[model samples]
Target: MFGPDKCRSTDKVHFILQHKNPKTGKFVDHHLKFAPSVPYDKLSHVYTAILKPGNELQILVDGEEKRKANFLSADYFEPAFIPPKTIPDPDDKKAEDWDERDKISDSDAVKPDDWDEDAPMEIEDAEACEAAPGCGEWKRPMKRNPEYKGKWHSPLIDNPNYKGIWKTQEIDNPDYFELDKPDFEPITAIGIEIWTMQDGILFDNILIASDEKMFAASASSDVLSDCQKKVFDVLYKVADIPFLEAYKNQIIGVIEKAEKQPILTIGVLVSIVVVVATAILRLLFGRKKPQVSCNVGETDAPGNSEENEKNDASAPHPRRSRRET
Candidate 1:
């Protein structure tokens, strides 16, 4: 079964190969999911799934192979379709004397006489006041005690009785069986099951046949190609008509109103022309005036001799006077 599915935010092509488990006598699904090369909703696309006699599988979109895998490969399928050859023996049990613990505490470890259990974990600094001057009535800070010994425990050692992990013996599976071509199945009827929040989900030209060449020929037929093209063309044309017609009507109405009011139309056109002309003239000929700067205590005009003498007396000593001195 191959179908379209939306997974979270992305659209995917979902494929399921169904087979009955030989051991359990129940049907199981081998799933393969991937994003389509082209959106199926946006355009018409041909999706194909092929299973060969050698158990080789291929998935194609628009005649281009997107995925290929062997049916028996564990990398492609989930819940692995094939049963294992060896099974854990149900009758086999672990030995009664099995020791699972890998490590044990030493029983002969003794506490040394120097090890003090009563010692404090931290001690206050005795020279704190001497180190910091004028730190009135100082509260000494605590530091970790170098000689402190914490609660003691014997070190761990490897257990001599350890037998590693216990396991049940293996036996040949009675239900296990192998098939040369696991892809073959008897077909009585075809069915499609779909669940969607959307409408207008279309399924067309569904083919179930063993002949690969026939399927390819049907997909590539000129009639089918033309039909798909026509459907797309008609849909787009119908969707565009309303908006296009509204624009056409507005243009026609403007022309009709202009014909009825020629003077008003001419006045509006003249105003628009004047505005455009003014902008262009400014852009071409507009220029800024050059700026002139004067010193803090000086004027641009030449002064009279009397004014010059007064200005010279009030000014600070010049660089020429300093050089001469």
Candidate 2:
């Protein structure tokens, strides 16, 4: 069973490993929390958890181990390390009048004269004077009552009738079997089952091996690259075969229809041939001729040049004359 989904701190990714208890026919969960959190908004690097045979587990993030745990004793696991059948006096009843306080009130204390017994603790000081309007009388402040014995209680003492905490009696677990050597139980399948809040999660390179070395070799870059190539080939070629075949059939149908009407087919074929021939001719000799500049190596017309020179010589430039003067 999965642990709590939401309602927990968002800072951690919780992983729960559950095993069936043969004796109780109930599932026991082992939970692990890892942090420096999961990046859900973007592509997060792969995280790996390695659990070895000897109750040793390591959490790795991006190929580096973050935390390691060694379970030398069953105390690290719950239900396996059961509490004793009896425990120190959890049920020991305390006497109703038992008192644990070390201090007592002093009976000789007296109230001072300034203690106005009738005055209220809070009087209106709104007038901004030493005395407020309609609140001249100050109430006496409360103090520890001298006559109070502070709820008399008897000191704590050992209980003569203290019966200890009751625990589950130990018996042989029907499901537990002894193993000859330290080895992991055989895993028949490996799968991923997750509850995600958003979509578009991409899972790749699921690897399983006997140990870290095998996993490292199998999940190498070269291996993953080959796997990706295979996947791409299958998707583009194998998966698209039906659609491609249908496309080819459609073209064939069009050709067959055209063949039924020879005149129309011939006309279309002639048009296509013309278009193809024109395209080929254009490709072979498409270079545009270098344009001749209208004024290239050419002098101005005699009439315009003479007229311009006459105009320039005849025109009186007042600014030029002033500079010359």
Local distance difference test values of all predictions, in order: 0.65, 0.47
Candidate 2 displacement at residue 118 in angstroms? 7.6
TM-scores for every candidate against the unseen true structure: 0.55, 0.40
Q: Which pairs of residues collide in candidate 1?
A: none
| Model 1 root-mean-square deviation | 24.8
Q: Write the per-residue lDDT of candidate 1 for residues 206-284, one digit (tens) a residue.
A: 7888888776765564122454446434433533454344334443443333333332344434443454455556667
Highest lDDT among the candidates is held by which one? Answer: 1
